[model samples]
Target: MRKWLVSVLLLCALPGLSGVCHGAGFKVSEQGAKAMGMGNAFAAQADDASALYFNPAGIAFLPGIQVSLGALGILVPQTDFHGTTPLSGTPPLDTGTAVVTEHSRRDIVIAPTLYASYALENLPLSFGLGVNATYPLSKSWDDSSVFRNQVQIASIKPINFQPTVAYRVDALNLGVAAGIDITYAMVSLQKSLYSPVIDPTAPAPPFGAYEVGSLGLNGTAIYMGYNLGLLWKPRRDLSFGLAYRSKITLDITGDANFLATTPTGMGAIGLSDSALFPYTRAHASSSASTSITLPDTLDLAIAWRPTDRITLEFDATRTGWSSFEKLEFHFDSPQFAAFNNQPDPRKWRDVWSYKFGAQYVVNPRLALRAGYSFDESPVPDQTVDPLLPDADRHSFSVGTGIGTTLGSVDLAYMWVHFVDRAVHNQEMTTLRGSNGVFKSDAYLLAANLNLKF
Candidate 1:
């Protein structure tokens, strides 16, 4: 029963609810900014408790017991949206018209993580375990003023669990780990507009309420995936690492609610005479279900220690976002092709990230770290929307750690600046019910804590 509950929560908590970043891309990079600030290139450089998130093998080297925790803040810019209805036939009496609108918020979110491990004194091998959230940030928007033609989306959060093991041989070491991921997600979409055609046969004044739809939709499901990582210490001062996270398939099933006004109901509600325009004369609800694919990822990293007081590291990673090209759903009857026959053209060409960082040892009990990285956006320009407002980004980060006889404490801050991106896809927006060209910008902050015994 707990597993079933977990499964349901996983679907409802994951997916990012079309929260932007090109589909569900934002959910892909939710690690604390300290890791992100370091370019997420710590696989080989895993020495601290946080290493549990990237490579569980690193935990084997930990002596005694240790723990770590922290949080991060993130912001993404909004995209421009525009839509137009091509007029083709005869002209009819019209009472109202539809216009375009937009909205972008600089909202920030905080993410936290925890890690623990123990080393055996009598054995040549070491074993460890940990639980932490990798994907940990999200955003939302619902402004009627700017998104008149666009679908309003709200609430997206996805979390996960990781466990691992490691061993050492002379001067070299190796390790492996796996992940048990859980997620949950919910969404609300709405589109409203005015049209200037009123039928004399139609009940009252302005032709009734022709506008609302899908006030809310929620889905919950459970998925399974794994993680593997490798670490090698070529010399006392040099270490290298590699890791991979498998993809997850989400099967969402749930209920939906919709609102609409028609000739029969509008006249009775006294709204038939309120406006002059085109309107929908029906409101209803239905069952909703969908299947979506999350992507997989691979990372390679290196760490170097030229002196007792300094360490330098670098990392590179690839994400299989291209695997997520379309979302399909099953219904009780004929399926509503909400997205049209548009095969997800998101050829999301694979992307790569590069990071460089350095940690300074001020003393046996103190350390400071700093890093820089460049990331590429996977969303093609034509499909960018509120569902995923992704763009190429630049990230910077800094942090410090204090050691104690029982454990250690770590703190970090990261700043991500999203370049302004403009979206120009009339057909794409129409499929998703959006108004015009879209544009936006964003930022983020983060923190973490670690303990050892």
Candidate 2:
């Protein structure tokens, strides 16, 4: 039977997406390039095709059919860890030795989106559609690192297809949208499974260590969710807006495989044993499944336009992170039951955030934007680990708009800095590869094209 005590612990790493969820808990806030450039404050002033995601209700005010295509590129985070905990057990090769390391991921992740909007002249109603990677993250690490058991590699990518409808009242615009998300998650990890080495000529109580191969988990799931929005224009220059996105329950199912070397790396060192996990070399595989919830959110925003050249915005967002309480995985085969078959607790609390932004129109063809945001972290220090590391954050952003002959283009860049997080948990004293101070910073670059037909 597989003893899942170990397996239960690693599932927490499965929801792992790189920096996609930065300030927020595992959710992407920037949907459209224009909204991103404006510090994601487009809820009340959603005048473009991207309104499909920012606020569908804005579609009712559009003049004709609109289409937009956009893409954002993110540089891998420079996350470094300084191990402050020490292992007090015997060591054959210092398997749990504390090592200071720099950022391991050296890849660039790209996020893309496509949107369309339509307003019927006689119906006073509008319809919109959007296609985008709602949550995008990726990372890779080396197996030889001392932190291998924590996380070697991970990737979480979720694509969303949303369709929306909106109705217009004299001063109020009401809208609702439905979405289908296809999420793909994968993880690779390496750790030592102690197989005691015995020697006849040595001490009565043998204390040498032999190592096995790495364990791997990969999964994919499709889920459903929805969003609602409302926009009210009290004056020609001022507007108020509210938006809500429902939480998603993802049922992840996939295969669990083992990756290791044969002939026992220990056998080459003269410690040939009768207890080397079967005869020569063995690699096991099994089926695994789990359930995870994506948090729900509520956003309130205000936008003010003064003198037609300057626009200012403020927003508040609350995320229901309490939905995430634990990480549990079930195995189809008894083989996994022998290694792992348990649940891990993660009592995350809800969080709130504030954002402010400004847009200045330099001319009819050019505009400039800047914004700032402060977001609280939902992951507590006691639960912080390499697999799921988090901390509060402050972000600064800048962007611009350019009008073209056939359409308009929006470009935005954001710099996110995570407040340094220090952890001192029970695992730090008990687990070999646990405990440390984590630091991270990220960059986002996006561009989009709007077409009117």
Q: Every model's Cα RMSD, please?
A: 7.9, 4.6
Window of ten residues with lowest summed lDDT in model 1: 86-95
lDDT of 1 by residue, 216-242 (tens): 556555556767767788787998888
Model 2, poorest ten-residue lDDT window? 194-203
| Candidate 1: stretches off by over 4 Å | 1-24, 28-37, 75-102, 124-130, 178-210, 262-283, 333-346, 428-441
lDDT of 2 by residue, 126-165 (tens): 7888888777666666665544545677776667788888
The TM-score that candidate 2 achieves is 0.86
Cα lDDT for residue 370, model 2?
Answer: 91
Q: Which residue runs of candidate 2 sit more than 4 Å off their true CA positions? A: 1-23, 85-99, 171-210, 260-279, 338-341, 426-433
The lDDT values for all models are: 0.54, 0.67
lDDT of 2: 0.67
- Model 2 residue 438 lDDT score: 81
**Candidate 1 local lDDT, residue 197:** 22
